[model samples]
Every structure is written in structure tokens, then in C-alpha cells.
Target: MSRTLVSALVYVLANGVGLLVASLVLGDSFTFTFKGFFVATLLLSVVEAVAGPAITKAAEDNVPALKGGIALIITFVGLLVTNFLVGGMHIAGISTWLIATLLVWIGALIAQIVLPRIPVKKAVQKARGKQPGKEG
Candidate 1:
């Protein structure tokens, strides 16, 4: 499958397993599925922030803001399934997740700008059908 599809599947599986475990361990009062979704988004953001530049550089291209937005939507829905597995839904604490996302974004931007050269080179080579760690 495509890399994006694989990532989506991983995200869904991670959240689903988390929710199932949470439900079994926590009771009704543990109803914080929304929080999980938000947190998961932030988690994905952090992953993107770190791996994004590499992936972009490997391909020497950006997927466009629209593509990123669609990825976000897919991530959100995947988490939704996780929340369903956990229990119901309760978004009593969304601000925390937002804050975390912002922090992750800042970090991602910094890393991408500072250490982008290597990734860019790798992306370019990869795009040309060259192996990453071998002389062509």
C-alpha cells in the first residue's frame, strides 16, 4: 500500500488498542476518549514534525497543505474509532491537546529549517530512484 495509507492504518491500530486497554482498565469515570483523540493528533503532529522533513526531503517535495489537511482528517477519524472502542465521548479537556499540538508544531518547524539540508539531499536522490545509503 501507499505510505500514507500505511501510516493511517498504524494510527488507527494504535488508537484502537489504546482505547480497548483503557476501557478494560478504567471505568465510566475514565471517559476521556476525546482527550485521547486530541492527544493522538498531537502525537501524530510530533511524528510528522520529526519524520516529515525526512519524508519531504527524500521525495524533494511537499504534499501540499491540502494533502496534509486530508491526512489530519484521516488521523482524526482513526482516533474516533479508538474513542468508540474505549467508551462514549467526552471532550472536557481539549485545550491541553491544542497546546501540545502548538508546541509540537513549533518544534517541527525549527527542526525542519535547521536540519533540512540532509533530508533534502536524500529526498532528491530518492526521487531520482537512487538508494539512500549507496553510491550510484
Candidate 2:
């Protein structure tokens, strides 16, 4: 899969699962709704599509945390755009939006960490720019 497609799927799935589990555990009315969770997932996918590559590219080069932090801010801007696109941006003066964004970011990071360990076949690796004895 292209990096963008894989990133979007992983972001949405992980965010959805995280929200579902958190809702069950917290029993909070706000986070317990399907709409809330799905909206957050959608927002996360948008962020991943836009800023994920930059962050991963930065990570590949071991960029300083300061740069990584800036990448994260860009990620949030992407997330807000997604949210506004799907469901208007009304902050409601509540912390749930912030909390949801943080949760999704954590989930996305986990997905990023786990994806590289999935072990592609040699042929597939080569096609994706990996070589048998050399890392690309």
C-alpha cells in the first residue's frame, strides 16, 4: 500500500479502537457516543494524510524533538481542518475536543511504531525501495 493509504487506515482504525475502549472504561457520556468517536477518527485520518509523512520523514533522520514538536502542531492543524470539513468547528468551551485530539495522536503514534514491524516480503520490500541487505 502507498504510505498515505496505509497511514490513513491505521490512523482511523487505531483511533476508533482507542475511543471505543476509553468510552467503555470511562463511562463518560461525552466520549461514549459513536458519533464522537467516529468524528475523532475522521479528524485523525486527515491529520495523518497531511502531516504524518513529514513527521515520519523527520523521525527517519532523527530530527530534534523541537522539530518533531512543530510537526505535531501541523498535524493538529490538519486535524482541525478535517473536523471542520466533516463537523463544524465549535469548541463548545469544553476540554473533550482537546482530549480527543490527544488520544488520537497517541493512537496514531502507536500505529506508526507498529506498522514498520509488520515484515514485508522480500519482493514487496524491493518494490517499496527496500533491498535485501540494505535499508532504504
Candidate 3:
């Protein structure tokens, strides 16, 4: 597939996993129906794709000191926007909101680091198999 498609898939999967972690960790305070999980993931992905760059740019320009934490803020904003825009996913309690944001942000960061490795490993294995003196 194209690079853009692969990137998009990665983002969706990462967000889905992140949201799953949040729901599981925050239990009563964060709830999602099966369908709501997928809906929320897609909504979050869209929101991040559309708004993330702009937000990051504004932050970079206005407060360079926030560069490191801008991603966390963006992720939190995505959750808030998704919560307001989508149905079935419910978030309650101030503490839960904060925890959910941190959980999703950390989950996505983990996914970003780990998910791409699988394909890369496969490609490396295939390349090794094609080496000149290699036997099948």
C-alpha cells in the first residue's frame, strides 16, 4: 500500500488501542460500548489529523517551551473534541479525564514506537533471504 495509507492505518490503530487502554484503566469513569470504541477512535484520528498540526504550530510560535508537552495537550484536546462530537463514549470525573488523557497519550506513544517495527522486521528478514549466498 501507499505510504499515506499505511500512516493512516497506524494512526487509527494507535488511537484505538490508546482509547481501549483508557477505558480499561479508568473503568467506571470512562465507558465505551463496543461500537463506541471504533467510533471514538475514528473521530479522534480525524480530529488529530485536522487540528493537530495547527495547534502544534501555534504552540511552537507562541510558547516554544511547550513544544515537548504539546503532543499531550493535542491528545487531550482530541479526546475532549471526540467526547463532545461522538456518542456512546462517556467520560466522567475530573481525575478520570486527566488519567484518560495521559493513558491515551502514553498508549499512542508506545504504539508509535512498537507498531512500525513488525513490518520493518519482516522486511529485514525478507532481505536476508534474498542475500546472494543464502539458501532457502
Candidate 4:
């Protein structure tokens, strides 16, 4: 896949994983219908993709000390945008919102960093196993 396409896919997948985790772990606190989940995930990905860089750059240019928290800020804004600007997700309260943001950030990290490597790792192992002198 092209880098841009892979990046987009990864972003959406990451958002979905994060929302899924939040819904599962937080239970009623973070609720969404199936359709809502789908819409919200897509909207969230778009929002983050657009706003994330701008937010990071703004913070870097203005509040450089806040640089480290930019990802969290982006996650929080994405969640807020997903909740209000659209009609899919229903974050119950403040706690749920914060936790959801954290979950999404962590989920995105896991998805981007760990998820893609899994298939590659498996493929490498399979290829090695088929080699002439390979063990295990």
C-alpha cells in the first residue's frame, strides 16, 4: 500500500481500537450504537488527521513547553469533535471523556506501532521456517 493510504488506514484502525476499548472497559460510561460507532470512528479519524498537526504546530510555536502533551490534546479534541460535531458517540461525563482520550491515544499508539509489525513478524517466521537450514 502507499504510505498515505497505509497511514490513513492505521489512523482509522487505531481510532476504532481505542473506541472499542473505551466502550468495553468503561461500559455504560462510554456507549454507542453500532452505526454510531462506525460513524464516530470515521469522523474521529478525519478530525484528528486534520487538527492534530495544526494543534501540534500551534503549541510548538506558542506554548513550546506544552509540546509533550500535544498528542493528548489532539486525542481530547478529537473526542470532543466526535461527540459534538457529529452524532454517533455518547461520552457520558468528564471522567469518561478523559479516560476515552487516554484510551484512544494508547490504542492509536498500539495500533500504529505494534499492529502492523505482527503480520510482518509472522510472515518472516513462516519464510524462515521454509528455508533449507532453518531451525524452529
Candidate 5:
């Protein structure tokens, strides 16, 4: 597999894990059926991959003060877009949208940080004919 494919897979896996963790943590307010979860995960991954950079750039240029908070904004927008575009996912019952946004942001942040440290990446590298212990 090419490096691009491996990178994309890693990103999708990270986002999927993030979404799963968020759903588990938030419980009823954020829920997804089995099919819904997969659909939502795919949609979220696409949205983040395509729109994330542009959104981050816009935020940096227009709202410098929001630099740190932009990730949360992007995550919230991604969730909303995924929910709107995919019928399987549902986000509801929150008194404020901030709670939902924060949950997703935190979950994604944790996943992105933690997933790379897991053996999954080593497995992927091994599958690609690369030695796990060697750094490129």
C-alpha cells in the first residue's frame, strides 16, 4: 500500500475511534445505530479530510483569538454535517450545543493522540512490508 492510503486509513480509524468514544461518553444525547455508526464515521472522516484545513485557515485568518478553539468548532461542524447528511446518526437531548461540541473535540483529540501510539499503526506498517521498529 502507498503512504497516502496508509495515512488515510489511520485518519479514518482515529476519527472512528473518536466518534465511538464520544457516543459512549455522552450516552443518550449522542447515539448511533450499528449502521448509523459506520455511516457517520465515514461521513465525519470525509468532511474532516476535505473541509478541515480550509475551515482551520479561515478561523485563523478571521478569528485569531479562536485559534485554540477552532478544533472544537471544526469538530462540531463536522458532527452536525455528518448528522445532517447521514440518516443513521443522531445528536439530540442536549441543553446546549456546547456540551456536544466539547465532547466530540475532546474525544477526537484523545483519539488522535492515543491511536498513533497503539500497535495498530505498527500492524499497518508490517502489512506494508516495513519493519515496525524502524523509523522512516
Candidate 6:
């Protein structure tokens, strides 16, 4: 696969994991159907992809203080966009929204760190296998 495709997949997976974590943590406050999860994941991934860089740029130019929070801002925006538009997913109350945002952000952050390394580990193991008398 191309780098872009791999990156896109990683991003989608991260968003999915994030959403799942948020839903699991928030319980009834953040609810989604079985199908709604996938829809929300895909939609959030698209929203983040489009908004991430734009928001980063805008923050850099307009609000320098927000530079460190670009990812969080993107996550919050993703939830907002995915909230009403995605049919099966529902987010209730201000507190739920705030907690969901933080949980999702943390989940995605962990995913981003961990997901890319899986392929890298497989590749390393495969490479080590090619050499004779090498121990992994």
C-alpha cells in the first residue's frame, strides 16, 4: 500500500478507537448503534483529515496559543460534526460532551502512537528472518 493509504488507515483506526473509548467510558451519555460506530468513525476521520491542517494553519496565524491544542480542537470538532449528522450516535449534555472530547483525544493520541508501530514491528521481524543465524 501507498504511504498515504497507510496513513489514512491509521487515522481512521485511531478515530475508531477513540470513539469506542469515549462511548465505553461515557456509557449512556454517549450512545451509538453498532452501525453508528463505523459511520461515526469514518465521518470523524474525514472531518479530522480536512480540518486538522486547516485548523493548525489558522491557529498558527491567528491564535498562537492554540498551536499545542490543534489535535484536541480537531477532535472536538469531529465530535460536533459527527454528533447530529450521524444517525445512530448520540451525545447528551455539556458535561458528556466535554468528557467525551478529552477521552476521545487521549484514545486517539494513544492510537496514533501505537498503530503505526504494529506494521513497523512486523516489517522488522520479517527483515530479521531474512538473515541467517540472527535471533529476534
Candidate that scores best on lDDT? 6
The sequence of per-residue lDDT tens digits that candidate 6 reaches over residues 42-98 is 999898888889999999999999998888899899899998799999999999998
lDDT per residue, candidate 1, 1-136, as tens digits? 6767655644444443444343344445234555654555445444544554555454435445455444333333433443345343432345533332333334334443444365568989999999888998
The lDDT of each candidate is 0.46, 0.57, 0.89, 0.85, 0.79, 0.91
Q: Estimate each model's TM-score.
A: 0.27, 0.46, 0.88, 0.87, 0.78, 0.89
Winner on lDDT between 2 and 4 is 4
Candidate 6 yields a Cα-based lDDT of: 0.91
Candidate no. 5 TM-score: 0.78
lDDT, model 1 = 0.46
lDDT tens digits, residue span 1-136, model 2: 8987776666677656544543443344324235655676677566666676776676667855556466455555655665566542333323655554555456556765775455556668878887776777
Q: Write the per-residue lDDT of candidate 5 for residues 79-112, one digit (tens) a residue.
A: 8899898887778864535676776667767777
**Residue 128 error for model 6, in Å?**
2.4
Q: Looking at model 4, report the run of 10 residues with the lowest lDDT sum.
A: 127-136
Q: What's the alpha carbon RMSD for model 6? A: 2.9
lDDT order of candidates, top first: 6, 3, 4, 5, 2, 1
Better of 1 and 3 by lDDT: 3
Kindly provide the TM-score of model 4 when superposed on the true structure, using C-alpha atoms: 0.87
lDDT of 4 by residue, 1-136 (tens): 7878877887798889988988888999998888999898899888888998999999999999999999999989988988986665688988888888898888878888877777677778787776433666
Q: Which consecutive 10 residues in model 5 have the weakest lDDT in total?
A: 93-102
lDDT of 3 by residue, 33-66 (tens): 8888889999999998898999899999999999
Off by over 4 Å in 1: 32-87, 91-136
Which is the winner by lDDT between candidate 3 and candidate 6?
6
